[model samples]
Target: MSYYVRERLPPRSTGIANRDQDRGRPAMQREVHLIGGTRSEAIRLAPVTLAMREAGLLQPVMIAAGKHTGTVTRTLAAFGLEPDITVEGTGNDTVEGTRTDNGDDPLLRELDELWSVRTPAAVIVQGDTTVSLAAALAAFWRRIPVVHLEAGVRSDDLSSPSAQEPDRRLLAQVASLHLAPTPLAAMNLLDERIAHTDVLVTGTTVLDATLAVTTRRTPFQNPAVAAARTGSTNRLVLITGYGSEAGGEPRMAAAARELAERHPDVDVVLAVHSGQVDALPGDSRVIVTGPLSYPDLSRLLCEAYLVVADSDGVAEEATAFGVPTLMPRDGGEPAASLTADCARAIGADTEAIVTAASALLTSRFRRDAMAAGNTPYGDGLAARRTAQAAAALLGLAPVPDAMPVSVPVLPSGAHA
Candidate 1:
């Protein structure tokens, strides 16, 4: 059964107002629009949407374009979130397929049409995806306030180095409020001449969502899932990558084979993207699988001895789990991964990855030392804080204390 089928959205008012002011009189609920399209954006928005729903402070109107339908579906389902509206079939191909030949133009038109008749008090968007930037622009055009989540992430040069940096900068220009994840991010916004009042350090929501997923309580039904649980002799080595170099399936296959060969005892799980599945290496030791659901991926990370990936989200999630990671990116690393040597940049060279994996695998002291360092991400309270800030911004009632996260507690006298 669909999780969203059980949850219903709250009533909405035309304008935002402070419900606290009208204690005796009934007050109308305001609608806060939350939009996302890509996998990363959807993952980050999960906690915020859940928070809004739990608080009942404001009615959240969820929106999405089908950029990553599977990922978006899994993530939203994990959090029991369903979009109030989707802009997929007005014109052009569905968001799940090709994103070329003026792909985003149709999305822009759809969003513009949505705003033409009914505009929310504010539009909340996450990350630097094209869909996010488009939504922010649409809200800005309608003179609706834009709330940018995970804002102020800077790349090497804002000259379209990876397409994300430019999108982030443009979103910053139009966003009325910027919820930066770190101090460096806040400083970046300030340096860009954004008002200090508009910028708030709410930490990253990814960690909050990552921590929320607990180990399965019931007996495993799937043989593959049951086998993925790490045993005494099994050391899990998880790999994920994107872009031209290591992101290619052939390159990832080679790296996986190399790692498996070097460490025969370790179990290598490679999360292959859909585009590169055809070239995946067929090896018994290396488990080649399609993109994992967020919960399953979180479970793997929690059990992984070492991670070799180029994704920023992977780096951040690995850091929160205290799992040592090898970043295969050529240039700069994400801010969360660059602390206490938690993540190391080794380019896309297969030899470098094997060497690093070997060193970390053999040296228990080294891995333990790095894992003990402070997480560059936030405490597990990012969702609550972000939700609180959003309520304050929207003039809604304050968010009540959130329920504590359910993690597996070790038996008394057992070490964490």
Candidate 2:
């Protein structure tokens, strides 16, 4: 029983919300199942949960379903959220696709049984994670409408190592509604022959999460991070990535060390993957620490003078905070961020990293000029638009206005 679109709103660009009608309804009765299993999912989806609740449209039944259960829970908590249901997953991250029957897999079996007991009207899956693949497939099997958040993102590079590219492509097949984060994404889906009406550009929810968390002014837990961030007159360079995803952690570490050494006042911090700590350069100035909680990470991004991101690219978040970022490898999503004026893909190596950082560091004019560019992500109401679209799919509300086409946002007093 797939929950098809009950009603689509009359095309209204500017309209007010229903103020008095059904204003006092209890939230639980309007259950909308949303699945999350990773920190990124939690961060991206938290704002949507809030928007839906505030709008009195749909109440999300957040189901914790993925690897990194602990991190996901903590990340959700930061956004004042907790999963209504937690499905302890048994599969690894390397699972190819969820198209096959995984009767033996405890995670898939659990999802199957859960939905069978009390089926949801729809299941909302975020991004292209293995968790999303499993959950989307399970929902499809049960004839549940799947709403794919952050839909239509594509990587041009076919040789990429991860299964993310394929996961999203498969998701496009079953999702009843596609919430594309940008116009480019919507175009990607349209190019694939997805119905124009099915795709909506909602901007990226990650920015919503970033904006909300930045206002909180959370304290950094890592002593090194805390000390480095506080009362520092010089620039703070924040680097993040996993060697497994981006390749050669050691080179990134070496680059950080070199950047720190060359610039007397500059300090480098690598909010690194746990496994790759030993592989990094052994330098006192380069503060290497484990992965940060989402809030802390957002705070660091806000405070960062410059961001040196590997494949676990923070360009979106960095760009959101008006921070200049340098991607160490080939460009991917949010290519607008990596444009010449703001961020750059300097090729993943020690020399490229050092050279780029040096250019930006020595020339404050260069760094400030880059940061002056407008955030290609949008004005930061992505979650709100997404909430409206999701509710509209279920006949709860009308669709919100689409985001503007992507263009260079030149801040006041910015250079060409």
Candidate 3:
């Protein structure tokens, strides 16, 4: 029998622990399933889990599954979270709208079995990844409402190498609630004919995660970062990426070479994909390392003098910390980077990178001013807003004291 066809059973508890006036009993818990398989998804979703717990709303059941299992494990650990359930998966594919292996088919089967066991009020999926697409599809098939977090991002162009565009498009269509991270993103959904009532500008959860760590004032945990922190004469420039146009190791190598030769006082740290390490510039000034743990990267961002990255996620992180960033590509950057004057979009070339870095490095006043500007990305309450939205959808009330303040959306066309 199809899982969706099973006889529906009344929930045992509301999980709220609140007294039911009519029945003079505590309500039953509403099971809200959150599924993710990648490190990025894990990092962004951790805050939402905390917010939901604090809100006394639907119970957030975290399920970790995907190729980047180790990274996912570490990110959740940094947030002091343990997954309630973990689906067995083994594929290294991170591209959206594409599967790494047939591994996810079994995962889909597992999800079906789960739904057969107990239907959840909703399933939450974040960002554009293969696992996200699978989770959304599986939940939709089971007739469970799919809440899409960080929805409606667009490069505005259809052509792309990866399946990110298609994955996002499909997920939006099936998503019962769209949590757009920006007004521009909301506009993207609206343009696609998604109802305005269903779309909301909640800001990016990444900012919430960033704020979580920064507020705690976590000590520097990575030795490389700590060494850089103590080197008063060595300015730290954190770099990350994998795309050829944006993060290609060749491009990273060129930029590293130029910076190392021109600015010997700066320490350039290139955090690249493990496979591409052999392609990077062999320079002492360029500290080529494997992928960093979430906390390590957070600490590096907190203390880095400047950030030069090709990935949008890294840009968001740097902007959150008020660190100046130089995007090595022309487009596909978040609006906050430009609006906050915290980042510059430089074409993916050695000279453009070198020029931008040199200018930012020489101007201490400029960097400080960028850091002090209002964070155009978020105000550290996205997770709360997200939880509240989910609660409304599930017919559950959130804790009144933990309600989120209204966050203004950016003007349309800011990043399109």
Candidate 4:
């Protein structure tokens, strides 16, 4: 038997120290490179790429997986921005590379090659995926500045035995510019001693993405949304779980049994990741579906009365879609604070989850308020603002102002 070690070497930030000494340098036109670990990052980057092109800033380059290359390419084409570079054969997604023990993986090598060839002035990496971390590392080694989108989220209980805590902590340390989505996220970054100057509250680009897609309405007008609009005879609850090790399967099972027993009229749909379908509970009412595209998921979300899951970013996505959500306590502190009506602390017993779901299904006032409260998180313009922020950071001429509105703070203990 052979043993292997999997570790990400700490990033080298001192690579550009001497270059910083050379002041009064002529302004140089810079390339804005996006390193995507998954299809979602590529999708999210589309609007930013369009906004950059419209602003006449540097052309954007996307580094994504071969499996997702076509999807990424088509998405960019829809937005009318062609990638200057595309790298393939990483795996099904970026997480494949992160979980691999080999430090000299081809994807990492490709990232290094991309950095060497493009030499971007600033690199924009969205979210906290493994690909983002790898790209940040590559940029740091090359002395290029890094801008992290959706930065500053924390779960605080790393010892609680969750994988996201390590991922988020590493991302925070590597990023040069932290583009946080909320004041709470910004505050979290500042408390971590990241300079206030380096952190900006840009709101969430996902919100912007959500608003743009939802406005189209054709998708929402489909049968699924219509069915959802009809309301569940028993409550229709959506539950999502990610990462096999994070207690997702067990939690979903436990919650399902409790809900089925306590509220037999309410139906529970478990949206298992395609990879984890075998783990799904065998209840007829506990419908198991594979992963869905954003638009399709948003449509489903529109119809869903409530969303239950342990996925970090999905809760906010649900909020943007005006779907009330209940998140496991382990999801993260930021999401918990944002979704008072739906969120319960991590250790929520089966009875507690059942109680929460029952309350949400019966209360018209709670549903209305939750739908109204989700407006601040995202309005589907994050891609546009993210584009502007990326351009400005690259020292390009300022993009025309289309800044998103500030998210309103929820009253303390309002959801509880």
TM-score of 3: 0.81
lDDT of 4 by residue, 1-416 (tens): 01111132112122245334322333323456776655567667766766666666555555554446666665555334555556664532335223433555555556666556445567888876656766777777787788888888776756633245666778788788888776777889999999987777776766555444545554433343344435446556777766333555655666776676666676666666745445334555555555655665554555566777666566666765556677665334445336444343444445556677767767878766765663446446666667776767655556334334445432211132
How do the residues 262-305 of candidate 2 rate in per-residue lDDT, one tens digit apiece?
Answer: 99788788777745655344566678877777777787777778
In model 4, the worst 10-residue window by lDDT is 1-10
Cα deviation at 280, candidate 1, in Å, is: 8.7
Q: Candidate 3: lDDT of 176?
A: 97
Each candidate structure's TM-score, on Cα atoms with residue i matched to residue i, is 0.83, 0.85, 0.81, 0.72
Q: lDDT, candidate 3, residue 286?
A: 75
At residue 104, what lDDT does model 4 achieve? 50
Alpha carbon deviation, residue 54, candidate 4 (Å): 3.1
| Best-matching candidate per lDDT | 2
- What stretches of model 3 exceed 4 Å from their correct place? 1-28, 89-104, 219-221, 231-234, 275-286, 365-373, 398-416
Model 3 Cα lDDT, one tens digit per residue, 306-344: 888877888777776667788887667667467767777
| Top TM-score prediction, candidate number | 2
Model 1 bad stretches (over 4 Å) = 1-28, 66-71, 89-104, 215-225, 228-233, 274-283, 397-416
Question: What are the Cα lDDT values of the candidates?
Answer: 0.69, 0.74, 0.72, 0.60
Comparing 1 and 3 on lDDT, the stronger one: 3
Between which residue pairs do clashes occur in model 2? none
Error of 3 at 129 (Å): 1.5
Error of 1 at 231 (Å): 5.4
Mark the regions of model 2 whose C-alpha exceeds 4 Å error after superposition.
1-28, 95-105, 156-161, 244-247, 278-284, 330-334, 339-341, 406-416
